[model samples]
Every structure is written in C-alpha cells, then in structure tokens.
Target: METFKIEGNVPLKGEITPQGAKNEALQILCAVLLTPEVVTINNIPDIIDVNKLISLLKNLGVKVTKIAKGSYTFQADAINMEYLESEAFKKEGSSLRGSIMIVGPLLARFGKGYIPKPGGDKIGRRRLDTHFEGLINLGAKFRYNKEDHFYGVESPRLKGATMLLDEASVTGTANIVMAAVLAEGKSAIYNAACEPYLQQLCKMLNRMGAKITGIGSNLLEIEGVTALNGCEHTILPDMIEIGSWIGLAAMTRSEITIKNVSWENLGVIPGTFRKLGITLEQKGDDIYIPAHTDGYEIQNYIDGSILTISDAPWPGFTPDLLSIVLVVATQARGSVLIHQKMFESRLFFVDKLIDMGAKIILCDPHRAVVIGHDFKSQLKATTMSSPDIRAGISLLIAALSAKGTSTIQNIEQIYRGYENIEERLKSLGAKIVSE
Candidate 1:
C-alpha cells in the first residue's frame, strides 16, 4: 500500500541506467531448473515479480547464492519435488505471473509440474491456454482443477513434434522452448515470438548445450538433447524501461541520458518515439533525450490522416510502452490514436489522465484518441491510483509534468517491474517520495 507523492512541473536532468530485462530474468531463472549444475546470471533486476520467482525457486529447494548486487548463482541439484504439491506452493505460486514459466523446466527435468492460476496485472483476460496447449503438444498430459483454479502437467518422457502456435505469445513460446530443448526428438515451432527477451532465452539455452536455431525469427528449430549444462548469461537492458525514460524526458521537458541501452536490440522503439517528434541522440550504447523546450509535435500519416500507434508482435511497437506513448502524446502538438490490440482493459487508465486535464477520447476498450495539449494547457495535479505496472509509471510521468503536487496510491504495482524507481527518479531531480 505504498504511495508516491510527486511534485509536478519540474524538469529532470542527469544520467540513469536501465535495469536488466524483467521478462528475460523470468525465463532465465526458470531455465536454471533444467540443469543441476551451477548457473550464473548477471544483471538481475531486483523487482517484486522477479524476486518472488527467485523466492519460489528457493522454496522448491534450488540452492541460490547472491554473488553481487545484480548477480546470482543457482544450482537445482537437490530439488524437493514434493514441495510442488504443498499448500504453501499453491499460495506462493499463485502470486506471480512469472511462476507459470517454472512448470516448463520442471516438466522437462522431473515428471510433473503443478501451478495455481498465476496472478499478475488485471489488465485483461490473460489466458493460460497458450502455455498449457503448447506443453500438451510436446507430449505432456494436462489436468486442471476448476474448483481451485490449479493446473498440472506431467510426462515420463517428452517427444517433440512440429506445431504452429495460435498466437506468438512470448511466455508461451519461452515455456515450450524450455520443454523442447530436453525433449526426445527434433522439434519445430512456427509463429513463435521472436522478441529480444525470447531471443536471449534461446541463445542462453544454446550456450547451456541445448541446440536451438532461428534466434530472431518466428520459426524456431530445436534438436532435443538428453540434458543441459550450466552456463553464465547476462540479460539485456529492459527496453520497456528505456522507452519509459524517453517518454518521461519528452513529457517533462527534461534532458536525460539513459546508459547501456543495447541499441541494436531496441527494435523500432526509438523510431516510434521519433515519430512523436521527440529529439533523441545515440551516443555509443546510450540514448540521450534532449529536453522538449518548445514541446513536440506528432507526425501525421503521408496522406494527411491522423497518426496511429498500435501494438503488434516484436519488430513492431511493444504493447507495454503504449501507455507511455499515450501519456507522452498528451503534451504533444498534434493528435494520435493509440490502439492496444493485445489487452482490452489497459487503456482504461486513460480516465485518470483525463481527470488531469489531458484531452483524451476513450473510443473503446482497445483504442483511444489523444489530442495533445502541446504544453499550452498544463495538466492540473490530481489524486489517482495505479491500476497496473505500466499504467502506474505512465501516471508517475504525467504527475511529474503536471502543475502541482499529486498523490498516487498503490505504488506497489509500480515496484513489480521497475527497479528502485523512486530512487532513480530522485537522482534525476524528479520530486518523488514514497511513503
């Protein structure tokens, strides 16, 4: 129940480094269960969801040791399989969305994997069918308990098969890839998610002695191996956080430098922000966003139609940053339409921004049209509650650019993704305090 009291209308300056990819950390941590040897991981983000997964690993008897601030070593040699069936596990596993990933590595090494319906942001209907259906295609028997909303998968030995995914779900693809690496035969997955985080997982698995090809494409081929070995891996900087920083710089008229952003892997994020007329420079591996001293203007379509920003699979705009884009658009010089195709309820948070004096039209659950104030009309400060992780940060950015003090409740949602967000913002001269 933490609250953030942010003083608005202050410009931020300084350099901030993005945390390790949160999504990649989830998959890599689960991959540790695929081997009994020690696996070393670097650049781990100390966030709530990632930490919960690490704790779940410890409770399941994985030997975890802290090597440094953002590094850890994991060895799963003496896992207690019986712990998976306990009530404590059900409660603990249900608290994190990333917990669903553990089932794949567990099913690959052990004979069984069970999990309660994993919890996360209540943005929309996040179905588990993608994860379970992919596992079933890999020769695992699936069972469910409707009364308790629990799922279980078990197999004596998994034999790989060619399958086409219904959707390019990132976590689903990661789960299936983990299972297929140790399967008995060659496997081919078409229409797979090729996001950087998934690419990191596939590459890390290759380093650990699992054969996988098509690192950055939709078609993935895996040659089943008998077992995997431990390997050291480093996660990419979180692109979502980098995008957030870019939006924050634009909205608040701040000049900020984001260090070590993994530029080549950003995949259209920079281009998307540039379309909004924000000036960002590439200084080596860093992104330097100059203050929008005169405010920014959105680009219109070639045919003079309104600019539309929508979420698609990787290599396209990410859905996670659409919230930031919407918030940034509020202060731009022109109008743009934000279409959130993946989740229905994510755009609902726009109502809070509307209260802050942003001209927004919530067309439906999936789309919204925002007419930029162009800094002519500053958003009036207001009280709000964070609905989800991305929306929480979006609101925080809006609060920073608004005219007065704003109180945002339920900041715990913000901590689930961003690592030490308030402290990082404070270092950049953002007037934010958590209580």
Candidate 2:
C-alpha cells in the first residue's frame, strides 16, 4: 500500500550499484530445496517477491539464515514437503509467477509437487503449458482441479527425456532445468530460453555438482546427478534494473554510472538502446552514463525514417523492459514504434502517457507508435497507481520527467523487484520520497 511522491523535472546524478537479479535469486532459492547441504548465496536482493519466496521456503521447513546484509546460507536439510498442500502454500504459490518454479525441485526431490495458478503482471495470457509439458516428458504425471485452478504432479522416478519446449519461455526453461538436474538420466532441452538468469541457474547447479553443457545456447544437456551438494554462488546484477537506470538517466538528462554491470551478459540491450541515440561507455565492468547536456535523438531507418523497437525471446530485447523503453522514447526528438508482441495488455498504459500530452498512437493492444514532440514538459502531475513491475518503473520515469509533482500508489508492485528503489534513486539525485 506504499506510494512514491516525486518532484518532477530533476536531473538525477551520482553513482548507484545495481542489485542482484530477482529472477535468478528466485530459482536459486527454490533449487536449495533439492538438497540438504548448506547452500550459500550472495548478493540476494531484498525485494518483495524474494521475501515472499523466502517466507514460503521457511514455511516448508528450510533453515534460512542471514550471514550478511545481502547474503544467506540456506539449509533445506529438514524441509517438509507436506507443506506444499497447505493453504499458506497455495496462497503464496499463487501470488507470484516465480512460485511455479518450486514445483520442479519439489517434485524431483520429494516425488510430488503441488501448486496453484501463479499470478503476475496481467499483460497477457502466460500459460504454464510449456512447463507442464516439459515435466510430463520427464515422467511427471499431472493432475489439475479445473474448478479451482490447482495443479499437482507426481512421479516415483523421474526419468529425463528429450524436451523441445513449444516456446522458449524463460521461467518454463528454468523449471525444466531444475527438474532435469536431479532426474535419473541425461536430459536434452532444445529451443530453451538461454537468458542470463537461466544461465546463472545452470552455473549454480553445475557448482552443486549438476552436469550441464551448452550454458549460453538453446540446446542444453543436463546430466542428472544422484545428489547435489552445497555450494556458494553470487547472483548476477539485474540487467533489467540497469536498463531502467539507463532510461531514467536519459529522460532526466542526468549523469549517472551503474556499477558492476555484467557487460558480457547484456546482449542486445545496449544495442537496442543505442537506437534511441543513447551512448554508453563501458569501463571494465561498470557502465558510465554522461549528463545529457544535449538530449538524445531517435535513429531512423535506412534512407530516412523512424525506427521501431520490439520484443522477442532470449538474445532479443527483453519483453519485461519494453514498457520502460516506450516511456523513454516519448522524451526523444523523433517518432518510434513499440511493438509488445508478447503481451496484449501492456500497451494499455499508453492512455496515461497520452493524457500527459505525449503523442502516442495505440495501434492496437499489442503496438503503439510514439511521435516524440519533446513537449515543453507539459505533464501535469497526477495521482496514479502502478500496475506491474516494468510498468511501475515506467510510471516512475514518466513521473520523474513531468512538469510538477506526482504520486504513484501501489509502490509495493515496484518493490517486488527493485531493492530500496526510492533510496537508490535518491542517491542518484532523484526527488522521490516513499511513505
């Protein structure tokens, strides 16, 4: 129920450190349930979703201890699998999309997994068909209560098999990989999502004695091990958060540097933003964003025209961040089209932008054409509520660049990903106060 009160038109300055990847941390936390060994994970973000997942893990009897501010040693030695059928489990499991991942490890370790329909941003129809299909191929028997939308999986001995995911879903790929790591035989996954988050999960599993090859490619071969041992690993810096900071700096004409950005893992993100004419300098592992004394220009196509930014699977522009990019495009000096093919309802926020005097054409539910007029900051600050994680960040960007003050309600949605966001932005000279 928290909200952010922001005084707009202030150029953010100073340096900020990126937090650990929320997506990666979720999978790693659940993977700990597969073994009783002490799993030491570093750089875990203090985000709402992670807190919720940790609470769920605790309820399942995992002994979680904080070794440092952002580090934890998880021991699932006494984890009780019966909690998977509890009402608390159902409520928490249905609260976040990442909860579905627990089904894989739980089923593999305990021979059964129960989960309710997972909830997340209502951008579009995010089906769990790929997840269930992959697990079924690995010898899992699924039972669903259609009336209640609850699902259960059981298999005495999960035997790995060849899995060709119908689509390259990020969470789906991670679920399959977790289940396959402890299965009975080698599992080959083709057409998988090879995002950095998934790669991080694979690496952690390997460190725990899981044999996984093709780390950065779609074709992954996982050799199921008899048991995985405890290992210490650090999560990667969140690329999406780095992208958000880049967009905020560009929109507010701020000079900021994001530290510890995994430069190599950020494929296509830098290039995608370069289309907006934002130049980034990489000094070792850090990214430097100069003060926008001169605003950015949108790049046009071949002979002379506006360009378009769209989303796809791995190695493509991340769908989760397209909303942030769209808001940034509004401040540019040219026209650009944003095609959100993955989510039909994501473009619904364009109405709010249009109300702020942004010239946007909602071509449909899946696309929007923004003609950047660089309007003299006519945005009249209004009271709005955040809808999702990425959209919430976009609204923050929009509010920060507006003419007057704006209040964004339901900031808990933003906190579900970004850690101490208001404090972080405040350190960068953003006039944002949370209450």
Candidate 3:
C-alpha cells in the first residue's frame, strides 16, 4: 500500500546494476525439488515471488539455508510431499502463477502433486491448458474440480513423449522441460519457448546431468535421466530491468551506464529500440546512455508509413516491455502503433498517459497508436496506483520525465523485480521518494 512521490524533470546521471532475473530465479528454485543433494544458487534476487517460492519449499520440508546475501544453499533431502494438500499450501500456491511449476517437480520425484488455481497479473486470460496438455503428453494424469478450483496430478512412472505446445507459453515450456528430464524416454518439445529464463533453466539442468539439446532454440530434445545431482549455478542479469533502465535514461535525458548487462541475451531488444531512434553504446559488458540526445523519428516502411511494434513469443520484443516502450514513444517525434498481442487488457493503462497530455488512440483491446506531440516536460502531476510490475516502472519513467510532481501508489509491485530501485535511481540524481 506504499506510494512513490516523485518530482519530475530531474535528469538522472550515475551507474546502475540490474539484479538477477525474477523469472529465472523461480524456475531455478523449483528445480531444487528435483534432487536430494545440496545445491547452491548465486545472484538470486530478493523479491516477493522468490520469497513466496522459498516459503513453499520450506513448508515442503526442504532444507533451505541462506549462506550469504543473494545466495542460498538448498537441500531437499527431507522433502515432505504431503504438504502439497494442506490449506496453507493451497493458499500460497494460488497466490502466484509461478507456484504451478512445483507440480512438475513434485510429480516427477514423488509421483503426485496438488495445486490450486494460480494468481498473477490480470492482463488477460492466461490459460494453463498448454501446461496441462504438455504434462499429460509426458504421461502425467491431471484431475481438476472447477467448483473447488483445485487441481491434482499423478504419474506412477512418467514416460517421455513428443509434445507440440498449443502456444509457446514460457512457464509451460519450462514446466514440461523439468518433468521431461526425468522421464523414461527421450522427449522432444517443438514450438518451445526459448527465452533467457528457459535457457538458463536448461543450462542448469544440463550441468546437473540432464541431457538437453537445443539450448537457445525452440525445438528442444531432452534425453530422460534417472536422477539429477546438485550443482552450483549463477543466474543471468534481468533483461527486462535492463530494458527499463534504457527507456528510463532516454526519457529523462540522463547519462547513465548499466553495468554487467548480459549483452548477448538481449535478443532483438536493442534493435527494436533503435527503430524508435534510441542509440545505445556497448562498452564490453556495459551499456552507456548519453544525455540529452534529441528524440528521433520512428522509422516506417519503404513507402513511408507508420511503424507498428507488436509482441511475440520469443526472439521477439517481450510483451512485458511494451508498456515501457509505449511510454518512451510519447516523447519521440513521430507516430507508431503499439500492439500488445499477448495480453488483451495491458493497453488499458495508456489512459493514464493520455491524461498526462500525450496523444494516443486506443484502437482496440490489444492495440494503441501513439502520436508524439513533442510535448516535452508538459505532463500534469496526478495520483495513480501501480497496476503491475512493468507498468509501474513505466509510470515511474513517465513521472520522472513529466513537468510536475506525480504520486504513484502501491510501489511494492515495482519491488517485485527491481532491487533497491529507489536508492539506485536516487544515486543517479532522480527525484524519487517513497512515502
């Protein structure tokens, strides 16, 4: 229920380091249930989702110990799978979408798993049909009751099979991969999600004795193994945070350098920003954002038309970042269409931007065309609540670039991913305070 009060138009100038990815950390923590040996994970972000997953693991009797800051040692030697049926388990499991991932590991090791309806952003109908379908293809039996909203899975001995996912759901692909690695035969997953998080999960699995081919591509061929041992792994830096920082620097005309960015993992994101005329300089592993660069016109087709930026599954611009990109486009000198293909309701927040004096046309549930009015430093101060993690950060960027003071409520949403964000930005000279 905390709020962020910001005084706008203050240029940020300093260095910022992104924390480990939240999506990746969730998967890595779930993988701990796959083995009884001790495993150490470094660079884990301290976030709400991670804390919830840790709580779930401790409830299952996994020996989780924090060795140092941003590092933990986990021993699942005494995992009590019976806790999956408790009311406390159901409540915490249904609190976040990532909790569903525990089902795969639990079923793989203990032959049974129980989960309630999962919760997450209310952007749209995020179906678990693909997850259920993929797990079923891997020889897991699923039963659910709609009235009670409870779901259960059981597999005496999982037999691997070919799976063609209906949609490339990122977490679905990861859940299936985790289950498939321990099945009886070879499993091939076509149309899989190859995002950086999944890639890190696959790499960690391979290091733990799982034979997985196609590390960064959609077609994954996983050879089933009888058992997996523990291994130490370090998570990759968060790319969404990197993208948000890039957008933040551009909007505030601030000179900032993002340190230790995984330059190779940023697929198609840098080029996509270039289309909006933002140039980023990469010095080794760092990205430098120059100060006060004139916003350029958005590029169009050869025939001179308005460009449209849309989201796709993987190797495309992430749907999570479209909000930030749309907010950044408001200060550009041209018109562009922002299409959020994955989520139907994510574009609804643009009404807040429209209230701030930007010219935007909401074409439909999934599309909005933003025409830049060159309205530099003209946004009126307003009170708004944080809708989601990415959208909250996008609003913060908009607020920092506006003319007057803006108060954003529910800052815990932003803290779900970014670490010490207010202090980091404050070090960079941004006028942001939490009240």
Candidate 4:
C-alpha cells in the first residue's frame, strides 16, 4: 500500500547501475535446490519477489546466509519434505509465481514436488501447463487438486526425452532444463527459450557438472549428471531495468549513464530504442543516454509504413519493455504501433497515460497506436495506480515527465521487481518520495 508522490518536470542526471536480473534470480535460486552443497550467488537483487522465494527456501529447511549486500550462500542440505504439504506452504507458495520453479529441482532430487496455485501479476492468463507438462514428459506423474487448486508431481526416477515445447516459454524451459540435468540420460529440448537469462542458467549448470550444449540457441542438449556440485555464480545486470533507464532518460530529458549494462547480452534492446530516434552511446560496457531536450523521433519502416514495435521471443524485442516503449513514444516526434502479443491485458494501462495527455489509441487488448506529442504538450500529472511491475515503472516514468505533482498508489508492485527504485531515482535528481 505504499504510495509514490513525485514532483514532475524534473530532469535527472548522474550514473545509476541496474540491479541483478530478477527473472534470472528466480531460476537461479531454484537451481540451488538441485544440490545439497553450498551455492554462493553474487549480485542478487534485494527485491520483494526474490526475498519471498528466499524465505520460502528457509521454510523448507535450506540454510540461507547473507554474505553481504547483493550476495548470499544457500545450502539445501536438510530440506523438510513434509512442509510441502502444510497449510503454511500453500499460502506462501501461492504468493509467488517463481515458486513453481522449485518444483523442478525438488522433483528431480527428492522424487516429489508440490506447489499451490502460484500467483503473480494479473497481466493475463499465465498458464502453469507449460511447467507441469514439461516435468510430466520427463517421467513425472502429475496430479492436481481441483478444489484446493494445488499441483503435485512425483517420480522414482526421471528418464530424459526430447520435447518440442508448445511455446518457447521461459520459465517452462527453465523448469524442464533443471529436471533434465539430473535425469537418467541425454535430453534435447527444441523450440526452447534462449533468452540471456536461460543461457546463464545453462552455463551455470554446466559449471556444476551438468553437460548442456547450445547455450545461446533454441535447441538445448542436456546430459543428465549423477550429481551436481555447487559453484559461485554472478548474475548479469538486468536488461529490462537498463531499458527502463533509457526510456526514463528520454522522456524526462535527462542525461544518465547506466553502468555495467552487459552490452553484448542486451540483444536488440539498443537497436529498438534507436528506432525511436533516441541517442544512446556505448562507453565500454556502459550505456550513456543523452538528454532529449529537442524531443526524439520515431523512424518508420524501410517501405515508409508506420513503425510497428512488437514483442517476440528472445533476440527480438522483449515484451517486458513494451510498456516503457509505449510511454517513451508519447514524447517522440512520430507515431508507432505497440503490439503486446504475449499478454492481452498489459496494454490496458495506456488509459492512464491517455489521461496524462499522451495521444494513444488502444486499438485492442493486444495493440495500441501511439502518436507522439513531440514535447509540444507536456503531460499533466494525475493520480494513478500501478497495475503490474512493467506498467508500474512505465507510469512512474510518465509521472516524472509530467507538469505537476503526481501520486502513484499500489507501488508495492513496483518493488516486486526493482530494488530501491526511489533511492536510485533520487540519486539521479528525480523528485520522488515513497510514503
């Protein structure tokens, strides 16, 4: 129930570092359960969702120790299998969508995994079939309690098999990969998600004695290992957060330098922002975004058709940044269409931006046409509530560039992803206060 009271029309300046990848942290943390040895993880973002998962791990008897800020050591030496059937677990496990991932490692090592219906951003229908079906294909028996809304998977031993996923779902692929790494034989996953986060998981698993090939492609070959040894791993900087900072710099006419951005792994994010005519420089692994005092312009397609920005699997534009893109487009010089293909309800937050004086046409649940105001008309600040993590940050960006004070409610959603966001913005001279 926290609120962000922001004074708008304030330009920000200074250097800010993006937090560790939240998505990767989720998958990586769950992988800790695959071994009983000590796993040291660096650059862990202290966000709500990640902390919740850590707490869940502690409840399940994993020994978690804080090494320092953004670092932790976890050893799942004595897990309480009985806790998985408890009411406390049902409530705790259902609160986080990431909790679904622990099932994979649990089922791999202990032969049984149970989870309550996981919950996350209500952006759209996020189905669990992908995670469960992948485990089932790996020789696990799946059962569901319709009345209690719980899922369980168990197997004496898992045998590897090739799987062609229905969709390249990231978390689904992570679940299956975790299970397959300890499975009886070699496994090939086609049409898998090859996002940088997933690649990190594969590489980390390899360091732990799991044989996984094709790190950066859709086809992953995993050879089951007898046992995995723990290793220290450092997470990459969050690309989505980096993209958000780029959009914030443009919309608020701020000059900002984002440090340690992992340039090579960004994959089309910089190019997508350039298509909006935003000027960003690469300065040795850092992204320097200059102030857009004169307003940026959107570039059309080569054939002169309107520029259409859409989300696809990795190596394409990320759906998570489409909200930021839509908000940034509001102050650009031309029009662009934003197609949010993965989630139907994510674009609904555009109505709040429309009220802030952005010229946006919500064509449908999946697409919106945004006509840039070119900074000729400054957005007027207004009261708004954050809908999800992405839309929440997008709204904060819009509010920062607005003409007056704006109040944003339900900012807890924002904290679920971004760590210490208000302080980070404040260090860049943004006038934001949380209450």
**Local distance difference test scores for all models:** 0.96, 0.89, 0.89, 0.96
Alpha-carbon deviation at 145 in model 4, angstroms: 0.3
Error of 1 at 195 (Å): 0.3
Residue-level lDDT of model 3, residues 1-435, one tens digit each, is 799999998888889999999899999999999999999999999888788889889999999889999999999999887788788888989988899898888888888878899987778889899888988998888999897699888998889899799999889998899999999999999999999999999999998999999988999999999999999999999989999999998888889999999899989888888898787899999999887556656788689899999999889899989998899899888899999999898888888888888888999999999987555546677888888888889999999999899999988888876788888889999888898
What RMSD does model 2 have?
A: 1.2
Pairs of colliding residues, candidate 1: none
RMSD of each: 0.6, 1.2, 1.1, 0.6
Off by over 4 Å in 4: none
Count backbone overlaps in model 3. 0
TM-score of 3: 0.98
Worst 10 residues of 2 by lDDT: 372-381
**TM-score, each model?**
0.99, 0.98, 0.98, 0.99
Off by over 4 Å in 3: 375-377
Of 1 and 2, the candidate ahead on lDDT is 1
* Residue-level lDDT tens digits of model 2 in 320-404: 8899889888888798999998889988887778877788899999989987756454466778888889999998999998989
* Order by lDDT, highest first: 4, 1, 2, 3
**Candidate 1 ranges beyond 4 A from true positions:** none
